[model samples]
Target: MASDSEVIARGDWYPAHSSRSAAAALVPRTGELIAIGADGVALSVSVVSALSFSSRVGAIPRRIIFADGSVFETADNDAIDHYLRSSGHKSVSCAYRLEKLHPRILVFALLVILLGVGIYRYALPALVELAVLVTPPIVPELISSGALSTLDKTALAPTRLSEHRQKIIVERFERVASGAEGESYKLNFRVGGLIGPNAFALPDGNIVITDELVALAGGDDEMLAAVLAHEVGHVEGKHSLRQIYRAAGVAGLVMLIAGDVGSGVEDVLTQGGGLLALSYSRAAESEADRRSVDLMRNAGMDPVALVRFFDALEEKLADHSRTSMLSTHPGTPDRKDAILKYRAGSD
Candidate 1:
């Protein structure tokens, strides 16, 4: 028999048992002599039986006595495990305790979702409005016109001056525009007599083609159609409008915060045309490509023509060591590859 005043230290394990009589007598039952550890300081604990065996032992409880002389009597294994784990005792089944805190994890997830919604719904629209306020309108037109003129002066001026060829090009543009779905905007094809082979679409739906680019295509109508379709994609997607809005919004916000709203506004209006010349975001580019592919397919033109056009242009520009075409029109190869991949998947 152990003395009631014995002090149990840490790192001890012990066995315990209990019994009751109809006469209500305090009869001590034969039980395992469980080791008492310092972890059970100020309280008494006993391992009734080993439910699991690992680095830590799991067991059922026969009873518990509090420091206040209150006795907790139970035979529930789960209850014993819960109490021990909650009190920071190492157990073979500690994982169950962790699962009990699932509500806390759910609350954290809800907070994240609410934060995302707030940014998208409230913050994004306000930012977009601020951008619109600061952007100058003239910038895009100047860049578009300047880019066209630069191409024309160098590549297509000679061809454009030929009235007959100019008329033919004009008629082709008209034909393509007629078939376009939306209210047709003004479609002008100026032949840039530049030696550098390239073509590009302006935000305002103006399409400029270089003499070198046309020559590279060997004057294939289908290739021209593919190029035109791509330009149409740019217009239909309103890529230019979005670019201008984004730039203006950013400039406006910066100006407003800097306490120089007057100068910023003036600068934005004055440089509006140039700001419009800003490149479309990657998302805009992808959207344009998708639209162009769809347009080409709908127009009874082989979408593969776009692939061929890119390949030919790449070869020609590489031969001349001219990177301007690639620079102005980024992601050509990737777009081509995507088209091919899409076609393969569809088939």
Candidate 2:
């Protein structure tokens, strides 16, 4: 290492260049000189004025040697210390402090959160609404295509009853409902092998009367008409349709959470079919009862036949579980009350 006097004389003391690339080149001030090695060649350059450090570069102290005899030191010479101080050159610390934050990441995160919320709240509800509309209409088609086919092949085709009796029943129903409201609906009746003395109306206007139900009427035309009218009332009100839609809406929510609906749709449809086969609402049952009264009155039959038929039905069904019929049709007590009320009133 060169002595302090030699270092001062040679002006090899203060930083000759900024450590940072961004910092500007600095020259010594007047009455001072800076000795620097450039490309391995030593050179001394005299300064005419105080050297100014570039804001882009770091600060560098000056080294001076007086002509009288002593070396002048503006500041201590330490390269590591100077580099550390110059690190703040170009106002790096201040620039970093003032730097603006990128909002893109925050905005993106907010958008993802909002999208998730929309799918959960709004999108799911809309999907349920769509399923409601689609399910009702589809259920009837599925039942007609499957259940009716199964019954026709297995039960009705092999029945011992005369075909003429079946024809007569069909004709009577058609004649009575021919002029009724919603008469244009394609109405058909079939004999289902379902146990118990019961009958039911399907969503597609198909009414299934069990053999037990037929036998219970004792072949009385008026009694059969009353039963058919009540079932027809259920068809007209689309009670089965509403129930199907309700079940589908619930199934759709389950499928959505389970991921792929395509694989589960058949299972959902099967389960929904079982639910559809069960019962109608109390409000729906009442509406059907009222409709039956109207149909019987219009068909020139004593609407009181419905009351008598119900009395007979209540007796036969007493020991059986009334769950299925009661679910879709009103209780016997309610039906009896409705009949009495209708009988007392005029058209």
Candidate 3:
């Protein structure tokens, strides 16, 4: 080793004239920084200003930048530290200081992850619900139209019921719908196709009753009227729109947590948009059912007809759990039974 004052760092160097780097010592001599090679050749650099001193990463060497855009690197941090303090080079970045403290960085990273998850699981759902509640009526109409068109191509066929039956059902539906709180409804009839005997309402107040559902009633207008009233409840409560928005919000949250936001995975969330119309959460179903009871009473039909219809539908499906309450509406037997109790108490 050279004398303490003659050598600060013994490392590789690339001279201004040389295309190859060589073993050299960074030494201060005559108030200038110099690179001295083993061959006794010395090249001097006028250290006018110290630009920056970069922190070492793992076992990587440290990098030093000079004012002249020249770079110096060394793995000997002890020697480099001695040179910096002795040479009055105090220029260092906060990043360098932080890198020196590894534990703080790990704690900071963990906190950030926890905070993000908490916001997604709790705050995001409430915000989505509030936004859905405040959304304009026209937005639901636009969403419903797209969803209906998709269903028409896949699950629904043209109306198979006779004109007389369509007119009668429409007139009865109109009477109940006029008392509903939602926008004016247009009654639509279609063959249920593969969806089975079902009736569903769109966000924009289009209540579709299938031919199979009509047949299932066996020409009982009271039962069919009860069904229409229930669908009106869905429309008035904006249950379809709320369910879709909640689904979209959850999908977004999943994509965000998975680090796949703005990727093709969004298409997977939106592809079967029509299915949103078919499914109602248990809470949403309950709200609509309650509304249906009121609509039926206002239209002078017994709400008990709804309970009877549900029981009959459950029997016809053969699976007790295959009723509207379990399939998509998603309610418990207690909830199904409550409808009958509600009617009896009202009487």
- Mark the regions of model 3 whose C-alpha exceeds 4 Å error after superposition: 1-117, 261-273, 319-326, 345-347
lDDT of 1 by residue, 1-347 (tens): 23334311112222233332111101111321233323332233223232232322233333343333323333344544554564455763555445555897889868766765665557755766565455364655665566555544444454443567556655655555555655354545444433356556665567666666667788676777677776677766656655555555556655544445555434333442343336666666666666556666666667567788778877766765445556545677688888777666644
For TM-score, the strongest prediction is 3
Of the candidates numbered 2 and 3, which has the greater lDDT value? 3
Span of ten consecutive residues with least summed lDDT in model 3 = 263-272
Give the per-residue lDDT of model 3 (tens digit) for 164-263: 9898888878878889874989998988787778788877888777898888888788888887888898888777766676666666776776765563
What lDDT does candidate 3 reach at residue 257?
Answer: 63
Q: Report the Cα lDDT for candidate 3.
A: 0.71
C-alpha lDDT values of all predictions: 0.53, 0.56, 0.71
Model 2, range 9-117, lDDT digits (tens) per residue? Answer: 2223323343221111223334544443423232334442332322222234433432332222333334323533644433233433334335876787688667656
Q: What is the lDDT of residue 159 in candidate 3?
A: 92
What ranges in model 2 sit over 4 Å off?
A: 1-139, 150-158, 183-191, 254-276, 323-327
Q: After superposition, how far is residue 153 of candidate 1 from its true place, in Å?
A: 10
Ranking by TM-score: 3, 2, 1
